[model samples]
Target: MARVVVEVMLKPEILDPQGQAIGRKLPQMGFEGVAAVRQGKRFEIELAGPADEAAVERVRELAGTLLANPVIEDFEVHVAE
Candidate 1:
């Protein structure tokens, strides 16, 4: 089986409250020098066959339609090494 990765992230304009809360808490936890933080979702997909162009395209389509919200989020699909 081949592994594919689908990363979904909020758009730049969209507010990420979870990320912001983590960022604010990081400094208190002694993790410093952090400018900003944004959160996203990652999906590891196991494919039945090789991770070829066709497979990648299918994952991309899935990401666009189901994995990520096109109105407020963006997504990228890639084959895992």
Candidate 2:
């Protein structure tokens, strides 16, 4: 079986309001010294076949088509045996 990991994040130029809000509240909540914080999405997928080129292609397609918005977000894919 193969394992695929995907990560999706907003573009750097885009503002991450959720992350900024959390970061601001952390210090107020006494979680002091939190320099910076950012949020993103992580996904883990299991493939029926071995970790091969086809599996890699499938993961790439999934990420590009459904997992991420190409206009505002970027994604990375990783495959493991």
Candidate 3:
């Protein structure tokens, strides 16, 4: 079996409310010197074959079409190894 790691995140131009909330609250909790914050998603997918280029491409397609919003979010897929 093979594994792929997928990372999904909002585009830089997009506003992340959840991440903004965290940033705003951190200082109240005694966390200081904050620069910025962003929230993202990560997925570990396992396939029943080798982690070849085709397999990685397939995962990238899936990420673009299903795992991430192409309009406002970007995704990356890579072999675990």
Candidate 4:
């Protein structure tokens, strides 16, 4: 079996309320030196076969269409080590 990772993040132009809330609270919680915070989603997929180029392409397509909003978000897919 192989593992594939899909990471989805909002576009730089988009507003991230959840990430902003976390950034604001971090300082209050004693976390310092934080420049910024952006929230995103990660999906780990288990494949029945090897993590080859074909698998990566398939997962990338899935990420673009189903796992992320192409209008507001971008995604990357990779094979896990």
Candidate 5:
């Protein structure tokens, strides 16, 4: 079996409203030294086959096509044997 880990994050230039909202509330919750915060998504997928370069490429294509928005977000895929 193979395990794939995917991390999705907004582009650096993109505005993260959700993160901003949480950052705003942190001060009121007495959490100091929180200068900035950004929200992101992580996905783990398990495949019933060996981890290979072709499988990794297919996973990357899938992420680019359906999992993340290429314009505003980026994704990284890690495959483990």
Candidate 6:
């Protein structure tokens, strides 16, 4: 099976409240030296056959349009080795 991996993350300029919360809580939980945190989504799409150029391109298009929001998030789609 072929695997297409999609990684989605918030834009750098956007504030990440959840990440900040984690960052804050870690220090209180005795986890020091933690500076910052950012959270993201990873999607693994399995196909019946090997990933080709066209298939990767299609997945990239799908990720941009349906998976990640253009206004607040960015995404990358690639074939998993």
Global lDDT scores for all candidate models? 0.95, 0.88, 0.94, 0.95, 0.90, 0.92
Q: Write the per-residue lDDT of candidate 4 for residues 1-81, one digit (tens) a residue.
A: 999999999999999999999999998999999988999999999999999999899999999989999999988898999
Query: Per-residue lDDT tens digits of candidate 2, residues 38-72?
Result: 78999999888886888888898989999999999
Model 4 TM-score, all chains together? 0.96
**Clash count, one per candidate:** 0, 0, 0, 0, 0, 0
**True lDDT of residue 71, candidate 4:** 100
* Candidate 2 Cα outliers beyond 4 Å, as residue runs: none
TM-score of each: 0.95, 0.88, 0.94, 0.96, 0.91, 0.93
lDDT per residue (tens digit) for residues 1-80 in model 5? 89998789999999999999999999999999999999999888887787688888888988899889999998999985
Taking the tens digit of each residue's C-alpha lDDT, what string does model 1 give over 1-81? 999999999999999999999999998999999999999999999999999999999999989999899999989888889
- Candidate 4, overall lDDT? 0.95
Worst 10 residues of 4 by lDDT: 55-64
Model 3 sits at a Cα RMSD from the real structure of 0.8
- CA displacement after TM-score superposition, residue 31 of candidate 4 (Å): 0.7
lDDT of 6 by residue, 1-81 (tens): 899999999999999999999999997899999889999999999988889998888888888899999899999888888
TM-score of 6: 0.93
Rank list by TM-score: 4, 1, 3, 6, 5, 2
* Model 4, position 65: C-alpha lDDT score: 88
